[model samples]
Target: MLQTYAMVVNRNKNRTKLSTSSVEKNINVVNTVKNPSNENINKMEQSKKPAKRIIGTKIMEHVKLQPDKIIMKKKVFCLSNVKKCHRDDVVEFLQSSGINVITCFPVIKRTDENDPKAINNDEHSTMFRVCVEKKDEGKMKDPEVMLQHIIVREWKFNEKKLDFKNG
Candidate 1:
């Protein structure tokens, strides 16, 4: 069980920035103490985590789990005619069979122009694909028992039109 921690900084440290101008009869004290708007709080440079998931053991540190646990005998399986709703059910069934799910994603229904910069390209896949690692001997359960009626087949890697550019 790896644990991650983020630095907790006190945003309440920098109290109201007091300033007095000779031109004004009254000093304008920007009371950030109970200010309804917290615009100033965010500007303080204490610390914050990135808004995205990090890959490796960053210098800040966390007890990271070793990457790529499925070292050998990895298998890719394709589940056909799977809807978005039944996706979880399929994964649960597979896990019950004593296999570890390495990666699972839907097959994009639309075709890409092989352009990474393409704006309108989207995924509308009606099927789901999963890369699984077997528990011990890498044996898969029978297809008939999975989700009552779902076709399972081995997914093979195929060369795309612009494999180099996209890959």
Candidate 2:
């Protein structure tokens, strides 16, 4: 009976050793599959990603291509009290006053119902919408101070001009 008990203990020890070695071999195989050499990892990283294009870099390239053209921002303005002011005369006047006016045209109102400040149905006064370069925006305010019987108001983008009273 003692000999039989010793044989059972020896069999358990051998089974434990076999299981531990099998576990170690599995761990080594998994590590080798998951992580390759450092040189292989670098090559895989390079092949996986393509070269990226930056937006600012592309814009700069176009800007660099045009050397002669001066990039100027556009600004809009509302010129009021243009009762007898001709479009050509106004353009010439603005240009002469150091205001670089790109374009100016009369803003004709179809009806007085839209405008609350309209005194009467026939009280639609001649107004002009003017567009100029951003650098010449300061010149728009000058027309109000320099010219008589004319109101100059800077029009903001995507915003409605509420005040239409001649100042």
Candidate 3:
């Protein structure tokens, strides 16, 4: 019955890190359980007895359990569909998801080849593609789950725009 723990560092003493050798010295000793009835159990139990006293001096300093006080930079997934999302609805969704940026790609318009930048030019055309992705925060399964939620919530066709903003 041993719990493998890291060496506790005295923050007030100005220690930035635990001694690396401490971890190296007892690699196989931590978290190992020996059956009390086993012949070698006595030896294992005896070996760990001295380490038990230092358990309080050792602290868990792993990343998964550590607290993150700093603001995390969120990565927004740029989603594009055949239609565009309503600005107000998009804003609301972003607010709910804590998304700082909603990157939107422009819808490609079909036009004649007179303009070099026309859609007829394969190189210049823009087509919308929605990329299902995870929320900036929280425990969403994956992009596929996000896509399913979007489909279920029907955010793709929530509202229609009457006029296009001229750039």
Best by lDDT: 2
Off by over 4 Å in 3: 1-76, 102-167
Following a full C-alpha superposition, what root-mean-square deviation does model 1 have from the true structure?
A: 21.2
Expressed as tens digits, the lDDT of each residue in 1-167 for candidate 2 is 35544434456655534445877999888987798879878887798687884433234554546545555678999988777556777778788888888877666566854766553423334787789888888777764544787888876467656564952
Cα-based lDDT for every prediction: 0.59, 0.71, 0.42
**Candidate 1 residue-wise lDDT, 77-155, digit = tens:** 8778665444566567677877677766666544644645333323334576777765422445465456656667778
TM-score, every prediction = 0.40, 0.44, 0.23
C-alpha positional error of residue 88 in candidate 2 after TM-score superposition, expressed in Å:
0.6
For model 3 the TM-score comes to 0.23
Q: Which lDDT tens digits does candidate 3 get at residues 1-167?
A: 99998998768778576666777757645535332345567776687565432212234666476544533334334333313444344444545654444343333444644555543322322233222233443322235424433422212443655453651
Tell me how far the alpha carbon of residue 94 in candidate 2 is from the true structure, in angstroms, after superposition. 0.2
Q: How well does candidate 2 match the true structure, expressed as C-alpha RMSD?
A: 19.5
Best by TM-score: 2
Give the local distance difference test score of model 2: 0.71
Candidate 2 clashing pairs, residues 3+ apart or interchain: none
Kindly indicate the candidate among 2 and 3 with the higher TM-score. 2
